[model samples]
Target: MIKRIFAALLCAMAAACLSGCAEQTPPPEEHTGTRIALSMASRDQFLVTVETSVLEHAAKNQVDCTVWDAGNDYVVQMQHVKDAREQGYDALIVNEVSPSLTRGILREAEDMPVVFVNREPEMSALTVGKNAYVGSDDSEPGRFQAAWLNDYAEEKGLEHLNIVYLTGIEGQASTIARRESLMDHLKVDHDFVYDSTAQFDRAKAQVQVGMLIEAGRSFDAIVAQNDEMAIGAAMAMQAAGKELCPILGIDGTIAGCQGIRDGMLSFTVRQPGDEQGRAAVDAALALIAGESLDTVSGVTLGEDELSLMIPYEPVDAENVEEYIS
Candidate 1:
């Protein structure tokens, strides 16, 4: 009965893929009896969306899933992994609080199949056949942001500009990759007039940018590591009655898409939360069943064979409406 149900679930997933659904449809009822545990780094806005999708897909596939939130604490996250392993979970999906802790978490998991989502871990920690990662290529979003900014500058006839840069939590893999790649790919001559870490918080970003405004710092553009900080910068400029400049961000979140529609954000790189969440669940199940990760639909394995990458799309005014809902 379980095998039949799982087979039907795979067919449903394949059908959704064929139909070109951005968010894959979940299978009907739960009868597979597969149990998995999702250990999350935090319940941040973007991650909450991923969690919702995971729960939805788990329900549809009849997998028993338990979610543990670490409140952004690596120690707490490690405890969750230990719990999952000791409790006899069929598989474990982790959104690590820190990529540096991947090795420790893997040690706790022992021989259990593990899938790391969103937060990219070090390559050394991942063994292709044993564990894998499912998320976007962190560097791509930065490249997209840089390309858009370059074109914007060219169109404006600006040879050089003062830019404000907002970064996520310091030392995080995504923060490093996004910032470094943006700097590497940017073609325009620019100076970072105001550069600081907003820790991926909207309020923090607003406060920081507000201070810059108070100090009378001039900048031609704002680039944030994620949509939350980007939206916060927009709010700060509006509150101070300052004319908005081209604000660019990653994470094509709902609010980010809306910001583009409202002319608050110039553009964002859309990271499909729903797709990543669904892929994480599917990967976990496959590993538990002793199946290959390549068999998973709607995701491509990274060259390392330890990563299942979801592509990122650029979203701007020209196509923002399509992502608004």
Candidate 2:
């Protein structure tokens, strides 16, 4: 009888122990969301458009994002990165103030995933696991510019060409790639009459091109690294009462689209800022979620698989309307 009673007591204790163990076991971890930091080089028109797109997509993807404008200053940009890290950002999207300063940025960013956008850094600085670049193939826009000019010349049965090239900020990846591609390809059959940096500024391009026109420098074509400068060059030409030649540009901005519609710009390559912005956000989220870039749509790893190049399209009278909408 005492043994039976002891057995009943042991069963009750075992049941109690099992219930206590069940209560003590932890549930699976719940994922709240991701926080992102976007540091911009400046609030320029193109970047502003990109910023808006990023915000739109971030909201759609349930990622919290904050943007800090670096005002084209390297020191300020570095500070922004540090702040983002201290604030516990899951990832960073930096439009570097200068491409050369990326080394410092990576050092300051430490463990955070960085998606460099618009202006790209050196390939050596990029790494597949932690850091990546997001931009149009820096070479494609310039190549398209040259290719379109070539086709136009061929179609019109034109022979000689005089070109004025307005460059972006010196040493920038985009500026270097675009200028090199255009000059190398165009020089095969054309003369570069005036080639200089307009610092990616409309007013600067206007002043420089105005001076070129005033000096009676004759050119049959003008190519600017970006649409803002291209539009500015066209404005300078209009101000001088000179007939507009084939004014080509890249970054098919809204202004550039209007320029094509208004017959001020001959053609522009659409760099798809919206797509780039969305890609950056998506890539950031994917990194936070520990997902592979290969599984992500609208993104591709570079040759070394360390960067992402968004596709670019040539926009002109033929296909400008689709982009405008």
Candidate 3:
């Protein structure tokens, strides 16, 4: 009876131990508390591509990243910058709302790293901050578009052609550079007129462009600063019975590629928005780790200046289907 009692006690104790072991949970996974903030100008297709690309790179590097859209408001962007700085982010990647507005706010980031991905404002602190920029040359694409339009018009035997320029948010460096490049390469003798600044608003773009066509504005081509505006222009032109004109846009988005294939637009410069985002993350990491970033002067695509001097492919009817589809 004593042996049986002892055995019963041992069995109970062993079962309890086994149950406790079974109920035990593993330790919590360690998070490094390293966080980076991405501030984009708007929710348009160009920014979307860059944001998506950057997120992919961030995940691979185990970076805890948060992205914010400024809605194209300079004030809101400044507030976002202030919030990002105050929230103890390890780094900041800014696609500033206005190229100039964020410079002053960046001063608040004393010692906290800040990187500029797309827009380039002459922030005196940029070099001192040990920051790097990543973007393709916006100017070259503008030039390429201008020359291509000229060539196509001549091929079609269209003379006395008039250009209608649809600009982006007024002060973006890309806008300035692209417009100037377009003017410089296009036939100076012909007319290149500014239709209006859509300010990166797609609906506004459609409305304003539709009004222009309704006003009977004579234009041989509609030149949009980016793909979103180009799409809006196409819709407006189609609605107004002026869709026959060649519509050119920048930022070779998936939609832009599709536009060319469907004969909605003449051509687009394939600028990789994704590459910009991925570069921003990689550049920020390099900056934080005290590693040498390649001296990217003009504009950077990633950690390097890839084809800085006009690397855009003009997606036309012959190649658009294969490339875009």
Candidate 4:
């Protein structure tokens, strides 16, 4: 009887160990609610603001969102697309490193809905029902700049002004559109005394502008595709003990707005990063729910019905305080 009791006790102990093991074992990952993957081209300051807005909006709507920075590499962005697909993300929002690579990104995404933000892609790669582009019109900012500059020229009684043009990344759609539109819309006769690509980098702009100053290149005003380059040009002028001219920039970033208040930047066109980001998220959610892109508020669909544009606002010293905070 004692031997029988010992065998029963051993069996009971074995049963308890098995039960504990079973309890410790993790269950299969349950596919829960909607999930979205936001793949950014890089962690630039402007993009960071957009990212934050995206995250905040997603959370408010009870959606699971993940972000991946591609570090300005198309190859990495493609990999991220693949991972998002394999990991069962319901949708993707990408800020493409190169607009030319949009087709490859679309191919990698397969049937997954993608909302491209900030960087506009080729129209051919976008489909009305499958993919979409959400951002401000690139040409609009340039026109806004041109309007302000034209008024400044008129006020200064300058018939023909010598301008220094600082461009963004060479071959970028924004760079091309902004430069062309600014040139096309400006009312005053202006000669581009200096023109070069600053690659949207502040240091590069500073260095290039300093070299122009050192060489005694005469210019009445400076125009940059983005705020960073504009501020850099301002810095170069200050260092040379030159009075600041009408320095124009785009993006209306915090620094840019502050520059306006400080008399460093004359004005900037606000691109509304926060609005773009929130709209992108809303667009993604709408797509996930099988709704039309137009359902997303405060965005206007393009003529092709594949792009959604948020309007740009102009900020100058007169109203710089409104944008600064």
lDDT of prediction 4: 0.90
Q: Each model's TM-score, in the order given?
A: 0.89, 0.87, 0.83, 0.88
> CA lDDT of each candidate?
0.90, 0.86, 0.75, 0.90
lDDT, candidate 1, 1-325, per-residue tens:
9999999999999997988764577665548778999999888778988999899998878898999999998889999989998999999999888888989989999999999998887768887777989999889999999999899889989999799999998888899999889999999999999889999999999999999999999999999999999999999999999999999988899888999998898999999899999999999988888888998889998778778988999999888888986
User: Mind giving the per-residue lDDT tens digits that candidate 3 earns over 127-171?
Assistant: 643666666677888888888888887788777678788888777
Instruction: Give the winner by lDDT: 2 or 3.
Output: 2
The alpha-carbon lDDT assigned to residue 107 of candidate 2 equals: 93
**Which of 1 and 2 is ahead in lDDT?**
1
Candidate 3 — which residues are off by over 4 angstroms?
1-32, 295-311
Candidate 4, superposed: residue stretches over 4 Å from native: 1-32
Model 2 scores worst on lDDT over the 10 consecutive residues at: 179-188
Task: Give the RMSD in angstroms, all C-alphas superposed, for model 1.
Answer: 11.0
Rank the models by TM-score, top first: 1, 4, 2, 3
- The digit string of per-residue lDDT tens for model 2 on 1-325 reads 9999999999999999999998899876554578899999998678888899889998887778899998898889999999999999999998888978988999999999888887788769876778767788878888888888888788878887888989988888888888778766663378889989998899999999999989988988898889999999999999999899999988889999999999999999988898889888877777777776665578777667667777889999988999888
Error of 2 at 234 (Å): 1.0
Point out where model 2 deviates above 4 Å: 1-33
Ranking by lDDT: 1, 4, 2, 3
Q: Backbone clashes in each candidate structure, one number apiece?
A: 1, 0, 1, 0
**Can you write out model 4's per-residue Cα lDDT over 132-175, one digit (the tens) per residue?**
88998899989998998889888888899899999988777899
Q: Is candidate 2 or candidate 4 better by lDDT?
A: 4
